[model samples]
Target: QQYLERLKNKQVVRFASQAPAHPLWPEIERVTLEQLQYARLGVEGGVWQLFAEDGEMKMYKREEEVDGLAVDPLKAVHTVKGVTGREMTHYFFSPDVRFEWETTLEQMKVLETIADDTLVILQIHKRVWPASQRDALFWSHVRRVPNDTDRDAQDIWIACNHSTEHHEAPSNEGKMVRVALTVCLVCQTSIEPPADGGPVTRDHLTCKITYCSVVNPGGWVPTSALRAVYKREYPKFLKRFTQYVKDRCDKQPILF
Candidate 1:
């Protein structure tokens, strides 16, 4: 009887995401809010060094390592003329459109839908040569946070993804290397009333976006190569993702 009880407990932990009461849910909420705060803070001081730039987009990073592994923290901010934070959050959080914007993803699946605004997902990324392909399993949440600081500014929208476990999709299984990552995306929208006092159009909106991520490659990959890959990929990702959102939002009713 004791052995059977132990087996049941094991099974519960194995499928924790699907359990009646999910573990780490509180932590997920706390960390996600904290990430939004961090995103709003300005990146200054000597810790962050600017590495990439394009017009209104600027990228910063701090050089750091763990056991000789490159686990650099990245921050990027971009501004767009016509989209809202809600629209950006919508496309980013929706699993159906991920492949359209996330270029490196080879496969993606939603393991469980935790709620209307949250889910547990797994993704397999295309291999970066001379390294094993990678996979990530995590909980993703989307939220709207109040903007008390700027009374005139629209509410902020956020999408946060943090690593988590699953029974069927065990880590480091098969040929793929598992990656642990905490990624946060925050956006603030602003509106400019039409000069003609007419209906608000795309030209009357703008969005401010901040993206922060810390990715830990579970297995070893050359430090130089990892940094180079990040330097090249991060910029492209933000550009493509924002562009896609703008293109999609263009054809639809403005999400205010």
Candidate 2:
């Protein structure tokens, strides 16, 4: 009862966009509002569907026959609507995709508790960005920069070099080389750390490279492009650039 009371009092600031200059006037569809309400309920109940793709064929009646039975696959997806700046959550359950769901749910719970965590993060962001900054930044901005809607691939590259130039130059000098680069759906340029230090800081930009796979593939490359640089010499870069790529031509312009 106490926890429920506290949740009721949790106020998240919501933003209202300006009306589009169209015949529809307020243009807000009823179905959209219903979807938002359903999403809110989903988050409140922690109501997740336990579904399988292949139905009965995907599973066995008993657990012992590991060799004879087919595997069942499931997806755990939820949404956090009504809360300002919260993103939807999704989990794919393959043969043994368990820990990722636990970790993802834990993250969602953390977001739910903080309420204003994303807003505070945006407020403290080091970049001189506008209040209405692009939405991709809300999720995995740096990782998605290669094919980002707002910034171009070249623009992203410049930002990457500019971001780390101040901190890395004094220490790495000639040792630093352009090993790998990528743009994402959130913003344009993100560079891997040099052979020395792991990405200078986690300040929203240093997304783990493995997760880069989630980003749109149009403008980005796999991290393997930094192959020439030996691992020991560039431990930091090597650590993150294990599968790095070196192109940003794949992204298409975003409309809307």
Candidate 3:
């Protein structure tokens, strides 16, 4: 309690503690790269069905099931004005500010710090009606990659979160049911340089963001109920979060 109060507004510096190599390291690396590629793929493939759209943001999903469970993969693309790729990824990856923007989160904790750019997190989300409370434990990693195709463009940023396990805080040990998810947030920045040849500013930047996630309900949940929740929640989450980041940038120095 004391720590939470003191830590409310401060971003936790990474590498607070070291964790040994994980058995899923190979999967993590593979998934991270795969997501980067998948995210950049255009929606013209005629597979993804568009379900939600607002301004520059569009959300799509493909109906799919795994072992009689609804595990629809979601892909959302959004263009945010006045922020760079680095700024978007920073807010998405930082744990300290999550509560401020993640309206559905009930609690979060860092279970392990794998490196300066990686950490294991435990999060409990507000329960949806007629369903058991849900929790997630995942390893999250953030990195910046050079824009190989567009050398003059600002670097791209990626934040990947994939479900993981922890002995101390095992899932399904309590009333909360665990949800497995793999989420990727990828950002690319475009600059609209000043016509006056002045210095660059946040106003001259726009970040094109791709968010992809596949969540698997650990227990048997009605497919309709799950899809209903996702349809109602995802768009709201993305819009509110991006607005929050824009507001934060307006209030302080932009990360990039």
Off by over 4 Å in 1: 1-21
Which residue window of length 10 is worst by lDDT in model 3?
Answer: 11-20
**Predicted model with the maximum lDDT:** 1
Per residue, candidate 3 scores C-alpha lDDT tens digits across 1-256 of 9889668535333323232375656776787889899899988879999999999999999999999999999999999998888888889989999998898899999998777678889999999889888999999988787789889988889999999889868875888999999999999988888999998888888999999999999888889999999999999999999999898888576676
How many clashes in each structure?
Answer: 0, 25, 0
Residue pairs in candidate 1 whose N, alpha carbon or C atoms collide under 3 angstroms? none
TM-scores for all predictions: 0.90, 0.17, 0.89
User: Tens digits of per-residue lDDT for model 1 on 1-256?
Assistant: 9999999999666534432255767877788999998998899778898999998999999988888788899999999889999999989999999999999999999998887678899999999988889999998988788788887778999999999998869985698889999999999988999888999999989999999999999888999999999999999999999999999988689987
lDDT of model 2, residue 18: 24
Q: Provide the lDDT at 178 for model 3.
A: 94
Q: Where does candidate 3 stray beyond 4 Å?
A: 1-25
How high a TM-score does candidate 2 get?
0.17
Q: For residues 75-101, write the lDDT of model 2, one tens digit per residue.
A: 112111111110111111111222332
Q: After superposition, how far is residue 240 of candidate 1 from its true place, in Å?
A: 0.6
Error of 3 at 149 (Å): 1.6
